[model samples]
Target: MGEKVLSVIPARKGSKGIPRKNVREFGDRPLVGHAIETCRESELIDTVAVTTDSQEIAQIGRRFDADVVIDRPKQLAADEVPLAPVIEHAFAEVDGEFDYVLCHQPTVPLIRPVSVDSGIRAGIQQTADSVVFVVDSTHHYWKQTDDGFEAVSSDRENRQLMEPIYGEIGVFLSHRDLVTRGKRIGGSIEFHTVDHWEGIDIDTYADWQTAESHRSRKQLVYRVTGNDQNGTGHIYRGITLADHLFEHDIVFAVEPNDNIAIDMLEGSNYDYQVFDDNASFVNFIEETSPFVVVNDILDTTADYVTALRAAGSRVVNFEDLGDGTEHADAVINALYEHSNPPENHYYGFKYFCLRGEFRYATQKSEISSVDRIMISFGGIDENNLTARTLQALAELDDQLYVDVVLGLGYADPEQLDPIVEALPDNLQVEINQQVQSMAQRMEQADLLITSNGRTLYEAGSLNLPVLSIAQNAREQKHPYAFVSRGVLSLGQAAYVSEEMIRTAVTDYITDETRRETMRTALADHDIANGIERIKQIVFDETHENR
Candidate 1:
């Protein structure tokens, strides 16, 4: 018969550093349950068991599908009782003889099944009596001499120059006889090295917090505010960034009045919460204590970013042109035009956050004429840009067929009905709202008349010629929505003369060569990998800090 390995997780109910530490919740599972589950998941482990005097810990172990629960005597459950004897007692309680006895501490819940299995295989391969997991010790030891405190090691000049210092971790694998003899490392010992993060042992309140953070450390909190007045661009931007961070815990935070943000986040795998005001939002951030906070709101003050930083979160801002950019760890302004932003600020089309649909989208087919025009001004169109554009389109040839795309937050449907009804009999107009397939709709149209928002990037990805109009003064700073990038910028919607829109549309319709040139310009840039670049930055920060 093949060798059998028994995995034992020692989870005593009596904890001095933190009360009920063994049964305390770490992430979604109890502290001891993590160890039990990991042991059960290990391929090398033939049996999984837990040794505890407290029935509460035993119950938790059993609930996690542990094979056996050994009720340790009160003598072994004391604070000073060594883990070696506890492991031996648990092994004795199990029926079958085990070639290898593994002792995993419940406090180290971050330990993985693969690591356990690898350590066992390593022990067997090395023909060693014991195998212990360890991590590199970066800290230099100090000893108090008669004169003063001095460095323990002579080679204390630099960390790289030192030989090596490894601290023993919580995992131990030993021969069954050696464990019973109370000699875990008396025989030949093989060392299994793990990273510092994985080897963290929770013994105190601070250690518990560190472990808990490590357990839920990948959380990325997105703070976005959008509504009918301002539009849903911020919400869409946050969602785009969230999609890139799929492996991390994603959360969207929005203002209470922003129903558009709510509707967008509905049914999404990510969690969403609404804060009544800015103070409440800051409080929520402080309480959640996320690893990273991504702010997609238009502008941020120094106070807001400073408070978030004080709350213990790494901050990243999107499209932030305010003073908060000075304090933010990283700023991504994918829309704004800037030749030289700060070192941390990533601007220009190179950093443009493209939606998933547009990233791999096939090139849009070219039309001989601009008969099919798409008029879109983002979610709310607070200034009613859609109605204004339609008014200008009415002055043009009736042969023009307009597809007016309204955002989910569009407030005045009644106001638009009269404008549509008064259009010429020959002119055909259709309205599409809350479209799931924005790329599909863009693909159908040869030309797009839209505001300076994320849709501009989507249009450029599909090589769709755009007559872009800025929704507001802030949007007028958009760097990519210029004539050089295949877009005819009509300036801000409020100040732009109706004749300007009519002329730009009329000129583009007649000039097939110009339209073709614009479309070719749109196809020149490579934006398919922007999402990947953003992911790399976020993940790199997470791993380095971890």
Candidate 2:
């Protein structure tokens, strides 16, 4: 047999911040009704009761099928009165004796039934006199002193490094003897820490809005993969999309072998998990039952997307050209434009998501002379294009300044270093690795030489003229840069000789008219607000079916 536990909710009619907030409709039910439902659903709680001075609250409690509704005394319902006496009054009016009494606040409607059970279990297992719920407070404390206001602690470390301080969540469980003595908290106390969203206590209008926002949040899972072969553009794109979705619960689901994507996701604020294979990943999706599953992997299969939809998840795929595109809820192919796309398919450059740094970057200004040039491949230069591009630039005889930005997965650093060391004095070059901001670096250059990939869109947003070389067969299929007229494509790198690269660079430098025309063409397209467009598409597609 389980220990008998009585749950008591004390809701008064008088409220200063928002008048009559106790019986107000929150979400689909009244504010106090949520507390009643939570206690009734709890496995450990035997009896659920409400003690309120208002008759309306009593009716609501009865409508929600609460076990008991006690008439709270008028004196205990005042503005300045504390909760200890009210809980005591409710316990006295209850029919039978209970081993423990739980005081649950109606203001926090986001609290789950499992949390209540956890608090009761803690009090029983630990043999504690009381169990109080708390959350980690991130605010800095200060006090007024003779020399003006000063910090309460001498430690001035960052918020993450500082010692944690806990704030009560207005919900607690105590021994029956303590409740009868009109003391809510006492010796042998145990703390039950909850999530920050679950600790919200509604008092003001703003607090009510905050609680509603948290209540509407949904779980989102991003399935992405990255490595030396496929590059990390998909991981970068996933992180960029996740950053804009701050209101929703975000999780990154990757394969176990995707170590590059795991490393990138570790530096982010969101959470991620690794599944051993496709079968395990599908099982995880079924267990999680997320609102949406975004696939950033190059192409997904029909069977995989069908399993996701069967798990009640809306599937979103990026740059997918396989059979899964037909089954996905929405497919975004910003790199590859289709002539006859399906109704759910979104293509072209308008859906391209730029990084956050480019939002505040300064656009390029036309320079009469090509004094400086920047070379950058994607996150993983799988073909060692950086070294080849550098060698091509080293042949320039004019006094030229070159900046080479290497990616995190660039493997030919030893070979590239010797080339830079052997460059002539007239060809000055600087090598940078894993830069913080690519936009900042693009602003310092007159022209950009990059692979025919997402970097072209970033440079286009800055009005920087680009000369691109296709890194592989898959990249050669992307016709946006070639058709957009903003980029001068030199075909595939394997076919193009070093002399061809040297000639292209020399012609682009001397031809100011061509550079000016390319910049003007880039100004015609708006690529910076792709994040907003993609965000709207995700939300609309996910919520429309529901």
Candidate 3:
């Protein structure tokens, strides 16, 4: 087993999303070229090679500078056959005693070179069976149910309470022995958490986006600097992008922090770790041998994402900045970033947030009684307004089931006790700080009394009409304009007495006409499908560049 790492890009003819998507130009070269260039640019692996079941892909690989190309056997090339066997078949066919193996897919057009090389290094560092690239998920996830996808963990009581990694990308590296031992890393896995630029695993056309081109992998190194908290929403958004991949060493950090911001990543079933985000971040990119970094987080998070574009990294900034962004090997940021922020700053509702269907299911249909009005504030109530919301609910009809949802991170039990004691038997306090299914709870409810952030969006997406309140200024700012645009925003309910709470509750519940009015407004503004907008921006621009 020598230090001979072989970069493997498996190009098969069967792609449901893009036709001949593998060979299509990715940046300066074709799609498969990115993988080949990664090998040469890294200067770490022994040789850069392409394993193809197709002659077309081999030609494309060589045209892009592959050192060697192997013709794959039909059995190994056939679809539905697992990728591990195909990779093993390729190595055997290639017939070299290489120590490490890097396997990447052509569809991963947005994966950063830093992540590619880092993945190989992580696998080697762990000396484990294999290392795969992954993203962290902060929310609780579960298997699909008859109703729809469901949550099985406690992270969704409110979003800030969630912490965990969901593998989104599929970059992987393995030791030759690990692969030869009839083991495709069925156990003992390691992972690396990369920035959004290094992540963004594409499956559908929508998976590729242009609106976010400003921050494609290359420029992300600039944007993420000096911003550490999940406050900027990078770690949280990064998880959704990484969960599709296998496993890895997790996080690319020059100085790693095991802060509450990343605590959720530790709970998953993979061996993941962090890399320093400093100079070594560029070093890892060189190892992957990519000519450019794709900046995936430029627009949404930090502003310094382009700092890595300076030298060794040779970054390609893909800004979704409203005006077409600066140059790079590619412009994956489908939306152009103007030099200035917009007048509203919030942009339209499209930029607000993206949530999976799992965000709203509370799974409370099992409850036979409809008298209780379930109260769930959210995961991270940076403002402890749960008491205010509950107080408002308490003064209401006094005949409802008040299931107040609070996260472990928010509100103390002492703050909630007085309101809990005043409720009638009809209003039972079932603390769901640990319940996983918020959608089920929303579905089982008579009406929702929640904040206007993601909670309002999720409720609206699910058609659960809400009596919306803005718990804080940030939360408050979002709804009035939304309500002015025909969405409902309850003002000062958190500060209102129990009497005002009961009146609003009774008015919203008893009046079907008013409830339907709010319901119609939300359904019209359901931006839940923003994933499509993102997908179109990246992949469409990548393809269009060809």
TM-score of each: 0.63, 0.90, 0.49
Count backbone overlaps in model 2: 0
Q: Which 10 consecutive positions of candidate 3 have the poorest summed lDDT?
A: 218-227
The candidate scoring highest on lDDT is: 2
Residues 240-350, model 3: lDDT tens digits: 334422221233232365343345444533233345654565555545543334344444222233434345444433334522244233333212122344331223344
lDDT of each: 0.82, 0.87, 0.56
Candidate 2 local Cα displacement, residue 161, angstroms: 5.7
Q: In model 1, which residue pairs have backbone atoms overlapping below 3 Å?
A: none
How much does candidate 2 score in TM-score?
A: 0.90
Across 1-546, the per-residue lDDT of candidate 2 in tens digits comes to 367999999998998899989989999999999999999999999999999999999999999999999989899999989998988889989999698899999988998998878888988999899999988996679999999999976888888988888989879998988988999999899999889889898989998999999998988898899876676788988999988987888999888778889888897756999888879989999998999989888788999899999999988889998899989999998897878878898888889999889878998767577888999986667667788888888778889889888877777567777888988899888887778888898988888999989999999999888888898888898877787777989888788777778898899889889888888888888898888888877766332210
lDDT of 2 at 409: 74
lDDT: worst 10-residue window of model 2: 537-546
Q: On a 0 to 100 scale, what is the lDDT of residue 308 in model 1?
A: 92
Q: Please give the clash total of every predicted structure, in order.
A: 0, 0, 110
Candidate 2 residue pairs that clash: none
